[model samples]
Each structure stands twice: as C-alpha cells, then as structure tokens.
Target: MPVRRFYKLYLSPSRKYVKTLKNLLGFVPGNLSLYRLAFRHKSVAQSVKKGVKNSNERLEFLGDAVLGSVVAEVLFKLYPYKDEGFLTELRSKIVNRANLNQLARKLGFEKLIEYDNRMISATRQGSLLGDAFEALVGAVYLDKGYDFTKNFLINHIIKSHIDIHTLEQTETNFKSKLIEWCQRHGKDIIFEHIPNQEGESTKLFTIVVNVDGEVMGLGKEFSKKHAEKLAAEKACEALGI
Candidate 1:
C-alpha cells in the first residue's frame, strides 16, 4: 500500500475540506478559480462584473450530458447481457434529480454554493444543492480531465454512495400517484393542451387539468407527459386528493 499523507484545505463558510489530491490523484489543484466556478450559481450575476461571462448554468448543462454519458457507458459495459430498456431505466435511476441531490447533500456541497439572499429561503434549499453537484462534476472534469472525472464518479459518487437496489424499488412517478389519487376520489381528470413559446424552443406545452368541469390546475413543460403530470400534480394539491 502507498503511504497516505493528510492535508487540510480551507474553503468557504469557514469549513475545511481535506485535500487528498497529492495522495489520491497525485497532484494538487494549481488553480482554485475553476473550483470556484463549479460552485457558482447563475443567480449571482456579479460573476460577470468580475469578468466571468457565463455562470455555472453552462457548466451544469455540460456536466449533465457528461454524467449521463458516463453512467450509461458504465452500465452498458457492466451489464453486457442486459437489454437497452433495462440500461435506460438503470441510467434513469443513477442520474435522477433525487439521486443527484442525495449525492450533493452527502458531499456537503451546500456550503460551497454562491447564491443571493432571495434564493436562500427554505424552499430553494434543494435547488442550490442540485446546482452545486452538477457544477462540482463540471469542475472536476476541467481540473482533473475525463479519466479522473470517471474514476471519481464511480468510486466516490456511484459505488460508495448510491444504492441502486433501493432506488429501483422506490417510485418517483408523481403522475402515477396523481392518477391513482383521482381514481380513488372518483373524479374525472382531463388535461387540455395549449402550445406556447419559451425562448428558442418552438415546441412547448401548457396543460390545464379540469376536475368536474372546473379548472383545478395548470402547468407547463417541454413534453406532453411532463405537462400532463405537472397539471395532475397541481390538481392533486388543489383538491387535497
């Protein structure tokens, strides 16, 4: 076994994050800028004043794609005998918001995020964690390269953290739950689809769900399933169903 030497690194919120870079990855970060960028939230537009044009939103986008690709590749190689559908579901379990949020919480990334006072409210707590997690992944990729990113994800995020078996058994299908609730209450739910424009996306949908001919809820999403589900979920809340 190689000798392991411990070194403490100071970070924001007066916290100490142990740096095992020299021991675990054979190098220490020469630039902390990238790490800072990883925890940045777009809500803090002041990064532009500091000459950083883009916020971590772009990084989050890139990280999301990267994470999906890596997770899919790992599942594919690990289960060569499995079918595509199984792989897709497995990938979903691995990359879901809840799973990612759990990872962020476990990593204690809440301390690293830079957010405005408006976003610090209790309701927005989960949003910060999710964004930081994606930003961290993006930061890791930039700082350590693809191989290190892959290994860190598999070793730290996947193998040691996420429990695949429990996730597989858990149901996050809000739409299904909403439908069941409606059925139990003997209420006929109907979703009306209307098209709308959101930025460059030409294809957008607005859903109005009616319960007993009354407009109980409204929602918007990029897909029919998402729109319907959102509307259904809103309806569930409105009716207390």
Candidate 2:
C-alpha cells in the first residue's frame, strides 16, 4: 500500500495538516498527526478522550533528546580532534534556550504554534517557541525517521542558520566568567533571590549578586536561573571582568 494512503486510513482528520507540514518540513510527512500534535502546547491541550490528554510536552521531551544526540553526532564528526569539554561547550551554545528561541523565530515556527492566549500572552510567546521547535523535531523524527530529521537539522538548520565561527567567539557563560574573576581576586560570590509578595500568576524574582560582602549587581527576571545569569552579567560588567 502507498504510504500516504496507509496514513490516511488511520488518520483521516490530519489531512489538512499535510500541506502546512510539507511547507515547514520541506517534505510530506508520512504521519500527519505527529506534526499536528507537535504544535499543540500543553496550555491549549484538549482532552482527546476522557482520561487521555494530548499535548506537545511528551514530544518536546523526546525531541530534546533526539536533537541533543544528533547535534552531538554532528559536532563529533565536524570536530574530530576537539576534546570532550570543547564539544560539550559548543553543543550547549548551539542548543541553549536563547539560541533555540532565535532559531525558532528565524524559521517562522512561532506563527504555526497553537497556544492558549490567556496562558501565554504575545509578549511572553518568545519563551515557548524553543519548546515548540523541539516538539517539531520530535514530530519530524517520528514521522520521517531519524536520518531525514538529522539531514533536515544539518543541511537546513545548521548550514543556513548557525555560524559556528561566530558562536565560538561569543561568550555566553557570563556566570562562569564572573566566578573565575571572583576566584582570581580572592572574593566571595553569592546570589540571593528576593522574596516576591505579588499575587500575580507569574512570579518575578529579583537576584542580587554579592562580591566580598558587598552588593555588586542586581537583576530581575521571571525565573531564578535567568535572574542569576542577568546578575552575573551585570557583575561582570561592574567588575570589568
């Protein structure tokens, strides 16, 4: 039996997704439902039945692993002589949330996402795009198999979007840099998150970085991790490190 015909027999409702996915993926997917599910964010997940819930979260988890593996393999082949540390750092740089968010936006995946307007506003949509991109990768892997997805990432994404040379030159680990600076100057580095009393749904964290018993930098962000990074970045600038 033909692949498309076989897919249609099991998933007739996904026929409309075929065209959209073909344009996004550069090839017609064998299983259209996977792609459809990939765009369904948890915030907008509908109960497929009574107990079963459908969302891209599972696909995102799977895709994250698949993407990491593929990227590792690509880096291993691309830099055969580079040590493990160098490769790890490079991989982190490539797959980091900020980089992935930028990549998702660049590929126009943000427009295709199905999310809850109440849960995620337009201004906050940027943070969710990376997860959606990961889910898309998972869907591609499941629908088209590993080799095709690998090629899509390597030939289409890495070749067109990433400039490895520029990435190597960029300094993304501001916290690490600040830590090293503190170590060299014989200073203690500490990060503290201020308590939030706001009753809003989203909690904002204010992080203060202290150096040698003095407050050096302050940063406010939605998450503690980002707040720390922001504080470290400010500290790095303040200390001229």
Candidate 3:
C-alpha cells in the first residue's frame, strides 16, 4: 500500500479513536497505527507480512514489563520506609489479573478492542480488554517515550484509578490469608469440592473449607478456585480473623 493512500484510508476512519486516545492519554498520538494495532486482539490478528504475526501479544508483553517498572518505581517512591517485600506485594496487588481486568472495564477499553466475533462472551471479552489495555500501554511507550509513558501511568492510571490506601487494606487473596492464619494457629485446613448434578453445561462447584475437622465455610462458584476463595473469605469472617 502507498504511504499517502494508506494514511488517508486508515486516518479517515480512525478519527474517532484518535480523539478518544487523545482524551484518554492527555496527548495527541503521533502514530495512530500503533494504537490501532494495540487494540487488535490475537484472535482477529491478520498477517501483515509472510511468516509474521500481527497481533497485540508482543505489545502486551512489552506493556507488562513497562507497567511493572513504572509501578515498582512509584511504589518505591510512595513508600520510602517500606521494605522490598511490602513494595513487591503492593505491586502484585496493583497489577494482578483481576485488578487489571476491572481497570480495563472501568476505563471503557472493552469497546475499543478488535476481537473475534465468535468470542463475544463476557468472560472472553473481559480478558481481551485487559490484554488490550496492556497493549495500549506499549503503544503509548512506542509512540511517545519512556519518560512520557511513566508520567502517563503515574498521572492518568495510578493517581486517577488506583486507591493505594484502600489497596493496602484490601485482602486480594483471601484464601492465602486464611491459610496463613491457619498455619499460625496450628490448625489443619482442607478444601473439599462437592459434586454438582446440574449437568456439564451448567456445572458449578461447591467448596467446603474445613479447619481442624470443623467446617468453617461453604461457597459455590463457577470455578473451584473461586469457590474455595469465597469459602475461605466466609471462614475468615466467621472466625473473625
């Protein structure tokens, strides 16, 4: 494709995205093509050249690294007295899969991703939106620079979206906390999955958390891990730990 014609074709239709990007990032994008590529999920990726993959996966990887570096720096500066372990834990909470997915949804990123039409289910879309968010970070880094990317993350994402205080108080992994409590109190903990007769299509797992031979909590969720986590949360509330 000729450069001028390609620019006209892509730029014309992408005016709305350009405006949206400007509003979101607080800067006009120098390369709109990079942003467009960032929004293209692997499921709908096209081959731009022979034996080459044109998808957001590579960008996602880069973005993940960049995000980690920025977050680490922010945490280090924000909590100067804190130990390395604390900073690492805080960074994990901030960049976890569930948190990123929620952030992407809250920022209206789901509407911007170009994914496979067949995979339009809610769970799939949520995952894609999170990946696209990472890819967008990569695109910002490429279009702007490291310093600009860091500033954008600090000003737009960290200060705007994240509540550090609330995160400090939040228990991201209830199950892990409960396990630690159990270990400290010298109690044996076990999670048992109750079989569901609701057939394969609608099967839901019911998890029972037992501490020292006593059932502490029971919970049901679509996945066993989630069910166990919910049960652990209930157990925590019941035990007041």
For all candidates, what are the clash counts?
Answer: 0, 0, 0
Question: Cα RMSDs of all predictions?
Answer: 8.9, 11.5, 12.0
List the candidates' TM-scores in order. 0.63, 0.67, 0.67
Write one digit per residue (lDDT tens) for candidate 2, span 1-241.
6876667544567655665666666776776678878888888788777756699988999999999999999889989999999999899889876688899888888778888888875645775888888998999998878999999999888899998778877878888988987887679998987777578435788889999988889988988889999999888767644
| Per-residue lDDT over 3-114 for candidate 3, one digit per residue giving the tens place of the 0 to 100 score | 6545544576776776787667777777888998899987788777785578898899999999999999999999999999999989988987667888988888877888
Q: Against the unseen true structure, what C-alpha lDDT does each candidate score?
A: 0.70, 0.83, 0.84
Looking at model 2, the pairs that clash are none
Alpha-carbon runs more than 4 Å astray in model 2:
1-16, 48-52, 121-123, 173-241
Regarding lDDT, does 2 or 3 come out ahead? Answer: 3
What local lDDT score does residue 3 receive in model 3, on the 0 to 100 scale? 67
Better of 1 and 3 by TM-score: 3
Query: How well is each residue in 1-241 modelled by candidate 1, as lDDT tens digits?
Result: 2222222244432123335333332345544566677777777756455576556776787788778888888888887898999889788877866567777877767666777768565545666677767776777788778888898788877887887767657756766766676676677867787766557466677889887788988878888888887887777667643
